[model samples]
Target chain A: MRATLALMQSRLDDSPHLLRLGRLFSETVLIEVDGAEYYLTFRDGHLAAIAEGPSRKTPWRFALRTDADALAQFWQPRPRPGFHDLFGLVKIGRGRIDGDILTLVKNLRFFKEFMALPRTAPQPEETA
Target chain B: MTFEPVTGRYLTVTVQGRRQRIYVEMAGTGTPVLCLHTAGADTRQWRHILNDAELTATHRFFAFDMPWHGKSLPPEGFQTEEYLLTTDAYIETVLAVSHALGLDRPILAGCSMGGRIALQLAALHADRFAGFIAIEASDFQPAWYDIDWFHRPDAHGGEMGAALVSANISPHAPDAERWNTLWMFMQSGPGVFRGDLSFYTRDDSLIGRLARIDTTRTPVHLLVGAYDLTCTPEDARRTAAAIPGATCTVMDELGHFPMSEHPAGFRPFFADALARMKVADHV
Candidate 1:
């Protein structure tokens, strides 16, 4: 899980378009996977830090909760129907969305594109 | 020094008793195929079909931007009432456009909201059309979230529409084509997408009417994309299963905006459907 987050951060850093979209976008998005938590903090659209959580300290604007299997399926090179997208995950009962929906809607494109980075920009086999 | 095979025009039609100017595009010259786009989008979605050498050679493609979408501006005094796409208004406009264009029993091809309408047309007015291709559609599709966000001033309707619908396109789709599909949604007029969704998502579905669909009068074909969560393949299959003799297909590597998102991948399925329609017409 930590390895994937590392790759996600690396991929996020290299995305010029995402950086452009994230301009002045500062927020903490919480991603909960199988009871484990990952707080992705973005400063001006760049991923500043990804903090792991078993404790409650970081405040998040929105939280996307899913199992590890669902997250893996979502990040696949060619994900199946009802598993290829964030909303797809939520719609199919594989994932959950909580907190401010309007915030999620506002940064929707930015969120969708950046989250998809790990898939579009593939990493070495070792990472997989 | 070249131009696209497609040409654009405008015609005035009365929708729900109000005079409305509609923008339409067309290409080719065989059997007429009336194309209908998804919600918040316009006729630009059919550009690929209109330009396809093979399709244009065998079939005439005509697509119109429903009033308030694309170059088809909303009727005068539109601001007076909240915009909503009721079943009656939608059918009225489609019939008016078909009549105005002199299309003789054209084949109806619609996607998403357009798809639901295709089902309605088959049930209520089957003899008027040759066949129905309802792509990425189902009888009942409840929106995941509130529909109000699509039109409210505080929220950015265009971006939200683009973002939400983008989920329905396949990840393998060409970047340029994908962006073009999103751009159309982004260009939609305020409340226009919401208006369409009013009928598509919030309104009563075609459940009670599906059993009444007589495919022999007008064959019904439901095609869905693998990635369209809004109206998944399961939904299309279920809808098809209910309608007697209606056929359903799940298109791999395609999504809701198949026509506009990736023409190369979309054309084969569409061409195959057209062939089936032609066969049905002869029988």
Candidate 2:
């Protein structure tokens, strides 16, 4: 999990086109897997830091929460039907997106692309 | 560069008691093939097929924009009622156009909603066309999300619609075609995409429709993209099962909008389908 997140942080910061897409976005997005949460803070499109969750102090605009099983399938080399997409998760009832939906919708493409970074990048050896 | 092979024209036809000057495009000369686009999209979805040099050499292709989409405008009294596509109306328009053109059993190549209707066409009017080619389609597609957001005031309708469709595209699709597909989807008229989905997601009894489809009369070939969650490969296979002798091909590394998102990759699959259709005719 740690290695994968690090890979995501590096890819999100280095990819020029992705950076351009998220250039206007500056917000903290919570990614909750199983019960553990991680705060991904972005400053002007750059993934500044990812905090291991202590939800009490961290403020986030929106959170994409899902189970470890779903995430595990999603990060596979080729995910199955219901686990392949972010919205696919929602439809299949394996995931829940809470908080400000407007912010999420406004940056819909960026968020979707960011979440799919693992699929695009070299898969980390660590299992989530 | 000015004179491309493809040509465009208007066909004034009456269907469902309303006259519409439908925009239609054509390219090449040979056995005629009438193509149909996906929901919320115009004929431009078939641009690649229309312009395919190899296909053009062997087959003539025609594509049209549905009324209220692209260059085709709605009827005079359109403002009085909502634009909702029904099965009967859909069949009427296709038949009207085929009759207007004086085509002799032209093959029907349709995708998505157009594809769904192809099955209906095969059942109701099999003799009119040589065969049916359905792409990324199924007997019925379950509504996966709340379609209300597609046309609501707060959301940018076009972007919202495109966003939903975009995720279904294969990750390996080329950047150019992928963005172009999304761009066209982003130009959808307000409520138009939603209206199209109403018909696409209509829960009318398809078991009877499928049972009536005689593959012997109108040969059926279905192609579904692997990444298509809207109408998964499983759906296509199930549909083929319902219609005996129908063929379903699962296109790997492609998604819902196979033609628009990965035209180059889709060509071989389409060609294979065409070949199969030819063999069926000989049989």
Candidate 3:
């Protein structure tokens, strides 16, 4: 799971669309996966930091919560319903989002595309 | 109502002066509904519609694969080359298939690329169809996303294409339906998706042509999924407004590939549109 977040950070850094879409917004977001928390710091349209565990000093603009299983399925090559998207997970009771609804709505496309990056990345080799 | 097995066969037809073998599937009996599959997809997209006992009993559903798509291989001479479907070729194929099958003013229904062609048919040859049903279609697709990602060499026949498609699948759809929709994308032939997009995003333009359609002769109906980013409900409404008397309906909990993504959820909307078309036909 940590590796997936690291891969996501790399993908987000390299994505021109995400950078362009998120250029106007600068905020820290909290993504909680089954009690585990990760903080994403976006600055000047790029992902500046991805730190695991909650941040006590920095105030998060938004917080999204979901089970680890749902997060895993969302990153699958082809995810099923209830896991295909963040909003979809919420719709099916697998996930939820709180705080800064406006920020989320204003940059919905960027966030949606950003989270979907793992699916487009090359899969890791399977070990025997 | 009980579901019945659909019968499938290959029909020889001359499209664009080239002899091609088109694979067609048919079920039920009554008013002929000629269904067109979305780009890179085949007749299987209409499985739910074909198997619906009520729809079948009232109307005969026919879905055909375009040349070089699904079971319909390209003509013998062009087997080795990459097949790129153009607007002209697509229109001609649909016309040729309809003529070959001797369908009398069949109701033409299509989704995505198929949906776009429905408008082209109405604009160019309105008399050939009883009614036109366009799902997730629009006059223009804004360059919002990078289409090149789907065509990247590394992504070819890999998870990238399927992943992109899965994103468009409605998150509200059932798990089985979402997986089934992704299966279609995974099974599509190489370069077929990109080739289809050439027509979808590049060559096909119906902006000026929409006004030329005679709705009195052939009623046009537009249905869009609420969740479709490519062809949003607003786009469908704009298209509907352009064509005189064209009715537009926005389907909720549906996305780009509505029929395959959530056929059961989409059935009500499909039935409503078909019913309205039938009523308009009599009026």
Best by DockQ: 1
Docking class of 2: incorrect
Interface CA root-mean-square deviation for model 3: 12.1
Question: Model 3, residue A16: what's the lDDT?
Answer: 86
Q: Given candidate 1, what's the lDDT at residue B272?
A: 83
In model 2 chain B, the worst 10-residue window by lDDT is: B274-283
Ranking by lDDT: 1, 2, 3
Model 3, span B1-283: residue lDDT tens: 9545799999999877889999999998999999998876788889999999888989998999998778998788884676678889889999999998899989999999999999999999988899999999998775433445445453344234565555567766766777777777668777777778778888637898999998888889999987776687888999999999899998866888988888887888899888867854674
Looking at candidate 1, what is the lDDT of residue B8?
Answer: 93
TM-score of 1: 0.94
How many Å off is the CA of B36 in candidate 3?
0.8
- For B121-228, candidate 1 gives per-residue lDDT tens digits of 888888779999999889888877788888887777988989988889887677789899999999888888888988998766588899999887778888998888
Q: How are the candidates ranked when ordered by DockQ, highest leading?
A: 1, 2, 3
User: What residue runs in model 2 are displaced by over 4 Å at the alpha carbon?
Assistant: A1-28, A41-51, A54-62, A67-84, A89-103, A117-128, B77-81, B279-283
How far in Å is the alpha carbon of B6 misplaced in model 3?
Answer: 0.4
Q: Is candidate 1 or candidate 3 better by lDDT?
A: 1
lDDT per residue (tens digit) for residues B49-139 in model 2: 8889898998888898888787888889877777777888888998888888888888898999889887888888988888899998788
Model 1 has fnat of: 0.57
Error of 3 at B63 (Å): 0.3
- For model 3, the stretches where C-alpha displacement exceeds 4 angstroms are A1-128, B1-4, B146-148
